[model samples]
Target: MESKALLNENSDLVLISGMCVAEVLTMQGVFTFSSMLPFFFEEWALDSIEAGWISGIYYGAYMISVMILVSLTDWLDAKKIYLAGALVTLFSCLGFATLVDGFWSAIIFRTLGGIGLAGTYMPGLKALSDRLSGKVRARATSFYTSSFGIGSALSFLIGGLIREWLPWQSAFWISASCALVAFIIVWKLLGNYPNTTGLRSGLRSLDFRPVLKNPKAMGWIACYTTHNYELFAFRSWIVAFLAFALTGSLGNLEIQPSTIVFIGVLLGMPSSVIGNELAMRYGRKLVVVSIMVLSAGFSVAVGSSVGLAAPLIIGLVLAYGCFVTGDSAAITT
Candidate 1:
């Protein structure tokens, strides 16, 4: 049986670890645009709104593609979807690195990157869940989900360091290389797991009536939508805001804005994993509400902290990052 093949603890550990690493590597380009926003502003002569469109278009493409790609997982092998996504990411990063010269080109490549993420992110999560059962599945879910923060943090840190040392295009090249490695890891290592659901006959029908009728599910969806809006908006603009901050007395600070953003994002991985554990112990609703309130309070504090000492501003933003991702795993679980 499928569960029999998964009975070995060592094999299970290896599967979980491989998927986590692939997920992290696949996200190498996820925030490359945010890290290099300052250079683009100067080179492209882009206004704030135009730059936002370039950055925001990634999510727009993701939203459209995720629905189609993840839904197909019911009929297709998730491993296939993941492999395709990794290849798409690799090529999209290459395109951005080699071909992008202005706003329209950046938007085109960023959109492709988003479609690539749509194929991997949730579908990869689903693949992991399908192979494991009970408590092991729950713990693996938290680990896999938290790894996203690791990927995002690395994108900011590595992209920033590369941009500082080499040309701006080098950052995308590095991101492309990571995606290529991710493709190899999954293609060579991940074993296929077939879907067991009996509803395979209705492949053409993607009826949403059942989900829409569930008040509890819809309520959670509403909350998650709001959470994502705030979190992504902060991520898309924080580096630019910090760069602006440096024009003041804080200009002499040793830490780069991208490094600070990296620290803040890296801090979120532990916050997400630990928060899910706490929710399992106490109660999901109570834990989620408390985390949301804390996140909101920190957001306000960070906004009010402009022009303060570098350390103080950095502290507030880092705290905000922690709270922003704290409830992610819990909410999804």
Candidate 2:
């Protein structure tokens, strides 16, 4: 894998290490707010739909901002955009930590956080992609994609721990601090690319005509988008669903909801890495279809059995989490 070769060189090793650290550190902010959605609903007396809007607004901002921010990578060094993204994340977290009072305030702050994510995640991928080539490129991509699972897992774990031991604001503050650290890492390790300014400047006049003109590429993008939509909805609601399952007979079961989320998401990390390897050995199309089908069936089964025993429900959730994320790297690769 180019991953190993990237590490074999001392400078490339430093850069890759910095990228991973920055990725994990900043990504902790992405779900910190969502994982605390129940608290907001309770404290602010928000209805389900309103709460959904607050979460959805984040994606709205991300979708709009990423189109521009990600494209900037072609015109400039991705590292610069990443630094700006980290700064945006830091400010967004700080806003949530200290300034939120109601739905509107929360929406404003959360949307900024989403925009920050747009800057970091895909641009980081672009930076990595620019550095690798050949079969090794796909393998290295899998590793980077897998780390997103790790980032998400840690976010849930840390948010839950902070909510238990301190205040919710503490979690936000800690996430903000992590974002600052990510900015520093990128600043120190990532190279500036003044030489490449003219390379894609012409390519910067954004036109999706070429992308629309390519059926194969468009299909892959569509499939990936569908996968993301389902995956994100599952992530956002799994905790609430588990909490509801508590009212059935599982209330006495001794596990926090976020713990389940952490376990489910953490388990997904290795599943993504291993799943991509299997896709490489077998066929990518076959593996993607198999995983998507498996996850869809499991999701249906789990939904129908929400009233079942907590052990059964929790078991299904963990299993579902595995299959749900198993396709992530493979599809993206």
Per-candidate clashes, comma-separated: 0, 0
Candidate 1 colliding pairs: none
Please, what are the lDDT tens digits per residue for candidate 2 over residues 80-164? 8888899999999999999998999999998999999999988887787677667756766777777788888888888878877
| Among all candidates shown, the one with the greatest TM-score | 1
Which ranges in model 1 have alpha carbons more than 4 Å from their true place?
1-7, 198-205
- In angstroms, the error of model 2 at 105 is 0.5
**In order, what is each prediction's RMSD in angstroms?**
2.4, 2.7
Count residue pairs with overlapping backbones in model 2: 0
**What lDDT score is found at residue 308 in candidate 1?**
85
Q: TM-score, each model?
A: 0.94, 0.92
How does residue 306 of candidate 1 score in lDDT?
79
TM-score of 2: 0.92
